[model samples]
Target: MEGTEKPVSALGIEKDLNDWLSVTKSRNGTWWHSAFHNVSAMVGAGILGLPYALSELGWGPGVTLMVLSWVVTLYTMWQMIEMHEMVPGKRLDRYHELGQAAFGEKLGLWIVVPLQMMVQAATDIAFMITGGKCLKKFHDTVCPNCKDIKTTYFIMVYASVQFVLSHLPSFNSIIAVSIAASVMSLSYSAIAWMTCIHKGVIPDVDYSPRSTTTAGMVFSFFSAVGDVSFAFAGHNVILEIQASIPSTPGKPSKKPMWKGAFFSYIVVFLCYFPVAIFGYWAFGNKVEDNVLLSLEKPRWLVAAANMFVVIHVVGSYQVFAIPFFDMVESFLVKKIHFRPTKSLRFITRNLYVAFTMFIGMTFPFFGAIIGFFGGFFFAPTSFFLPCIIWLVVYKPRRFSLSWFTNWFCIIFGVILMTLGPVGGLRQIIVQAKQYKFYS
Candidate 1:
């Protein structure tokens, strides 16, 4: 009877469209794919802000926060990988799917989807601004005598690339892009810190707080934590990355996924630590929010670094955007019951890219946006959500190490999520007073 029944209902149709448009449809990714994808996902525009974050927090607190974030986020990332295939034969292909497994269906969607969407969207917006800014930097350095161009035009050029690439379907389709982005991330990160070391420490550098008032110091500390939190933000894309790998009953995707994630974290450490420490050492409290902006003397090297940043952000943009495209297409096809066609995807994705570009052009507060969104949504998704999901699903023993660890992360993340915005908002307001939109 069941075999005789038609799989032609509205629900069945929705499922089919979702599968067709889903970013995880191509399950051919390998461990190396995971490695580079993770790298591209984690090491983007945020790493450039580490020195500025250190400047705000000073030596002790800055180092402590960076170290703590690395350890905690890695542990949480491992938890996500392990839990990916925990349900005997089922794979939690999306972050929201895992959330649904931990919490009941509607509640899970409510909690995870909004946070995950915000994190992905915010990162894309940040990348747009970063790519545009770096492009402007490259232009300025190479042709100092050339007439100046507004940053808005550069940002539009950056978004135009995405409009073309966004047509690439599935996570695996963009492997080449992600790989190139990953390499560029490592390359530019090296250039940033190495250039700083070459420049040497500034004369009579001040290591004290940037702000004199106690309130200002405290707020900057909060914003600095947000900056550090922003640096380790690959967790949002982990499940989607894992979904692109093949899995079977004998050899689940988690094994290769974990291997890739482990090695990626090593790369993450290599990229993040040196940039924060050495850049801070070189510039002290006077370092620009974007370290690339601070290094001016060696024109050619700085120009190359800026170009590398442009390429890296261009590649990294898709790593975050694919999931977003999936979300948009799924909504249009499933909820609206629209037919899945190439035309539908082209229009939707192009519009999304244009929207982000417009926003980036409007409010290009690179550092403030990083700190605000990093704490506002990135904190929950990257820092503590995995731990919370672990406890909810696994019910780790009371007073056990797992229990204590999860709780500690939850507490720390909540504090970051709460206070990070306060500082970031104040900074944005201060910057806004001096900024002219689309100028």
Candidate 2:
């Protein structure tokens, strides 16, 4: 396949591929910038969705899960730093290329293609669903005929908004939006915490005396790890940022990007840990999909939190959409030789938005979507991908030991991924059996 291509069209494809490939070789970004970009990417839907995950494991297991996730994320970040240093100019697209270089094309594609699609699809669903929920909240609060507004409507509207927002002309504008959304989310979360803490409405689930079986312990560990994986799954984004960094005209300093990643992990863990712990402590077993629900806040505060969550979810969708859209664009241009004209870019962007919104509208249950994606698709993408990439790229001296760790991480990721989906599926199926439709 590599040696026998003679078609002129194939030459065009190769040229396009080479053009995209050039981005990987331009090493010009800083660690702090990479960290901020990554944080913006990962901190969205995960923060809103993690509390419910914690509820499943109870307090001790939950706290353990948070810490374990942080540790695993830190380790993964270190590995990512190593990969960046080893292959200084490669992006996620280049990871598969690296895999091909290290192993073979078939093996590389087998791993990268499916994992990439799964992660993006699941993330898109999460963004759409959460966005719909936020819009619903707004609708219920502001509209007189709020009950008439269907979940599908909100999903469609939000999806359209995402498509438009993401397709804006400038990168600076998008960054500005991300910054604004982050600020709003942080402010609202602070207010929600204050409201909840002041009212003393946080629930207390006593899991101190519960028997911790071996299997239970394992589940807790993976679940926590899974949470961390979700929280820190922006290594791809980091690489993208790294690739965007401008190299010196004549010479660039060889600063380790992992130093930035290490500190970024610390900053993320510090931000997430307190929120997860306190949010869980406040709500206990009764924590709802949005942890803010547990807080007995003023109407205005609740409204503010809902708006913040909506903005956060929307911002996340935009961030996720960029890569997904980029991949789509790359495939079309490189594989199909389709030029990315302004009109073509607009159409493609809108198409993704419409498709994602349609899915969200069809499946209005945010919790179910989060559970399914987090457990099934996200688990492997988060935990297994890095390990597999390490094993394949590095081959690590001891093939057997590396293989064992690779499989171990994969198995652990798979289990964590399954629990949420299986449990969520059970709940959905049972509910369907009992009732004709979603209430």
Model number with the top TM-score: 1
Any runs in candidate 2 off by more than 4 Å, and if so which? 1-29, 85-95, 139-148, 169-173, 201-232, 247-260, 397-411, 418-420, 433-439
Q: Give lDDT tens digits, candidate 2, residues 1-439.
A: 7877578987775555544432332344465545555556667667765665666666676777667556655565565545654555433334445455455779876766566666766677777877777777766655535457666767776776786696664222365566666565566656655664676533455433222566544444334334445655664444444554544424332243565556556656655765676666666656665776565346666766777777777766665666666667777876797876767678888888877776666666645445545665666655666777787677767758757766667676666676656554554554554432222
- TM value for model 1: 0.96
Q: Candidate 1 lDDT, tens digit per residue, 1-439?
A: 6785556785586556646765656888999999998999999989999999999999998998898899889989999999999887678888988999999888998999999999888899999999999999999999999999999999999998998998888888888998889899889999999998889999998899999999889989988888888888889989999989999988888899999999999999999999999999998889999999999978999999999999999888899988888877887876797788988988988888998998899988754767888889899998899999999989999999999999999998888888788788878877777777885
The C-alpha RMSD of each candidate to the native structure, in angstroms, is 2.1, 4.9
What C-alpha lDDT values do all the predictions have? 0.89, 0.60
Deviation of model 2 at 308, angstroms: 1.6
List the candidate 1 regions with Cα displacement exceeding 4 Å.
1-15
What's the true lDDT of residue 257 in model 1? 92
lDDT of 2 at 150: 66
Itemize residue pairs with steric clashes in candidate 1.
none
Residue 286 of model 1 has an lDDT of 92
Provide the global lDDT of candidate 1 against the true structure.
0.89
